[model samples]
Target: MRIAKVEAFWLRCPIPEAKQHRSDYGLLTAFDMTLVVITTESGLQGFGEAKAAVGSSGVCASIVSCVENELAPILIGQDARNINELWERMYNGVRDHYAIKRGRVFPILGNRGLTVSAMSGVDMALWDILGKSLNVPVVQLLGGAIRDRMEAYASGGWAGADAIGEQLLGYTAKGFKAIKMRVGVMDETVDYSIERVKAAREALGPDIKIMADAHGTFSVPEAKRFCRGVEDCNLYWMEEPISPDNKKGTAEVRAMTTIPIAAGESEFTRFNIRELIELSAVDVIQPDSAIMGGITESWRVAALAAAYQLELAPHCWGSALSFMAGVNIAFASPSAVVIEFSSGGNPMMYDLVEEQIQAVDGQILAPTDPGLGMTVNWDFVKEYKQ
Candidate 1:
């Protein structure tokens, strides 16, 4: 089927005051995303999400504009099933012929940032359309699932030392066996971040798997010190301890600490992930489908993780479309053992879709429904679209 139309809407849903939490990204007041819809000539439609930021809040106008003014024009009359060729066309711009002829990238100047983000949404929608056309789930299109279900970790913890344990236990009460907490600048000091993690470990005992995400706020030395202090806690992994800009510094911290380093949610494409792997900076690769180059690129990252013997835990902190996209990748990749479940007040994750995405006793079953396995809540989109 040929692509008939492409539309993008910027959706921003304000978080309820009681559900909000503070972190290195500051107190998140709203959740925002760019929703992309691709309709085929035969009346089939697919949905995808493009993110402006890794965190909960961002200005999505630019992403919407990029999809409408730039990417959509290139895609309107193309064959909807030509997903890979379309991706290269969007990336290579006018030089797509060269890339196709040479079997390598001849990317445009906008290869990395906003253009990639827009491409991510379009690529996801294309996958959704392909799966629908074949009457199969997205995971099946990715060579079927390796497991029936996958373990998930609660991905929100912002409480201070005094209340951190209780906050984490709340997630466990919901049957999550693993949990992640925020650290770094949010705590105001590296030592305080250490104390909070220690307290969480003490309260949860050794059975519960704990992870700490610094949101790329700490310096190299500070990350090293925090790792040193929490060495005894047996953290599942330490995530984004330093900025994404410093691959060497992240490698240095990883070398100094026994804690496995995890990163890549802030990155753009497989090329960025390739650098992280080459530098030996991370033990786990966490590609967010919405921010990185969508399912097409995330699957590539998962393959890299498998080849390199690294772990794959896709970052799933955005809308349900992105979260389900990550789940599909996780289920299909042998390297992916666990997926992320947001524990914060994320409206986009819950209210953006008609499906109820929840963990059952800390495990998520593989999706059997067609496409991304979610029905868009157009009413919700109408109310929230900015």
Candidate 2:
């Protein structure tokens, strides 16, 4: 089948009960998802979503434009069944040819990174098409699943100490064995943050696993102090204590704390992750399926982390589409420990998809449908077209 048409949709779903903490400065905004659809001449269609970062729809738009204009022509008559070959052809188009024009001239500006994200959306859609044609789920295409279900953790956005404690109990009661707490609201004192962690540990008791995220809000000294205070809280891990750019700072924090450090949500490709892993910067790897070069590069990142014996816990705070994409990676991955689920928005997540993935007794059921398996809500598509 030859190429027919490609379309891009940017959707902004509402967040009910938006709340903010002193640590986070940005608005606790609603769910915003960027959807990409590819149609083949034989009538088969594939769907993909890119996790739009804060105000990057325009970048995603450029990504789709490049796919439609530059890449689609090259693959018009190629067999879609050769998913790996197609992925290599598309990726090498940018890395081998485009990189010399972009990366060499203005390496600091990062145009190739943008191209990688765009290519990621297109590459994932191709895999979806391949899976559908073969009548198998994406997991099976990715060498079958390692587990039937993934254990999940509950996280609250802009939640206060009391609210977080109560939320932790709710998840605990629901049988969640682990939970993640959001921190680093640019606070100097960090006393309130420590108290929140202490309270969560107390409420959940000793057996439960707790992880803390600074969200790139803390400096080296600041993160050290904050992590030190909760040293005995029995945290499962600490995430993004410093900004992704400050490699030296991240390494310093990694060395200072005994708590396992995790990052890579902001990281894009295998090269970026290789630097982090080489420096011994983080104990865990968290790559967002929508953001970190989609499935192709993400699988490479998982393999890279496994070679280092590092854990993979992807940063997931997008629509059910992005979450399910992460779920597929988690299912096939052996190093992945837990998947993150947000308590930040209501109908925000539920309204964005046709059906929620089954989360029974704290574990998410593996999707059995061919490809990504979730239906795209076209009405929501029309509603949030930007």
Candidate 3:
């Protein structure tokens, strides 16, 4: 079916004060995401989500404009099933013909950042459309699932040292066997971060897996020190210890510490992930489908992870659309053993779609519904559209 229309809306939902948590990105007050909808000529519609930032809160006006004013014109009237070709067209811009002819990228100047983010949304929607047309789930389109279900780790922990253990215990109470906690600048000191992790480990015991994320706030030395201090804790992985800009520094920290380094949620495309792999900087590659060129590119990243013997734990911290997109990738990729379940106060995660996402007994089942397996709650979208 041909694409008949493309539209984007910026949605913002405030977090209740009681559920809000502090992090290196500061206290998140609201959650924002760009919702993209693609309608086919035959009346079928698909949904996708794009992000302006890796965190929960971001101004989505630019993403919306990029999707509506910039990319939509290129997408309308194209064959909705030509997902990859459309992605190449969006990325290569006017030079799409040359890129297609040569079987290589002739990307435009806006190959990254907002342009890619916009492209991500459109790509996801196109995949959703393709899956629905075939009457199969997105994971099946990606070659079916590798397993019936995968483990899900709780992805929020921001309590201080005194309460960190209790906070982590709360996640375990929800049947999550693995949990991730925030570290780095949020703690104000490396020692405090170390103390908090140690406390969490002690409280959760050795059987439960624990992960720590610095949110790219720590320097190389600080990351090394924190790793050294928490070496005995058996962390599942240490995530984004240093900035995404410093691949060498991340590699250095990974080399110095036994803790497995995880990164890539802040990155754009498979190319960025290729660099991280080449540098040996990360043991786990976390590609957020919303930010990392959608399911098309994220599947590529998962393949790279599999070929390189690295782990795949897609960053699932946005709307239900992005989260399910990640889940589809995780199920399709053999490298992915665990998926992320946001344990924060994210309205977009729960209320943005009609479908409910839940991790049962710390495991997430493979989605059986066609497309991304979610229906947009238009009423919620109308109320939250900014």
Q: Which stretches of candidate 3 lie over 4 Å from their true place?
A: none
TM-score of structure candidate 3: 0.99
lDDT ranking from best candidate downward: 1, 3, 2
Clashing residue pairs in candidate 1 (N, C-alpha, C atoms within 3 angstroms)? none
Q: For residues 253-343, could you state the per-residue lDDT of candidate 2 as single tens digits? A: 9898899999998887777899898888999998876677778878889898889999988777766656767788888989986888765
Residue 45 lDDT, candidate 3, scale 0-100: 96
lDDT of 3 by residue, 302-372 (tens): 99999999999999989999999999999999999999999999899899888888999999999899999
Candidate 1 stretches greater than 4 Å from native: none
Q: Model 1, range 128-147, lDDT digits (tens) per residue?
A: 99998898999999999999
Candidate 3 residue pairs in clash (backbone atoms < 3 Å): none
User: Comparing candidate 2 with candidate 3, which one achieves the higher lDDT?
Assistant: 3
Whole-model lDDT per candidate? 0.94, 0.73, 0.94
For model 2 the local lDDT of residue 300 reads 87
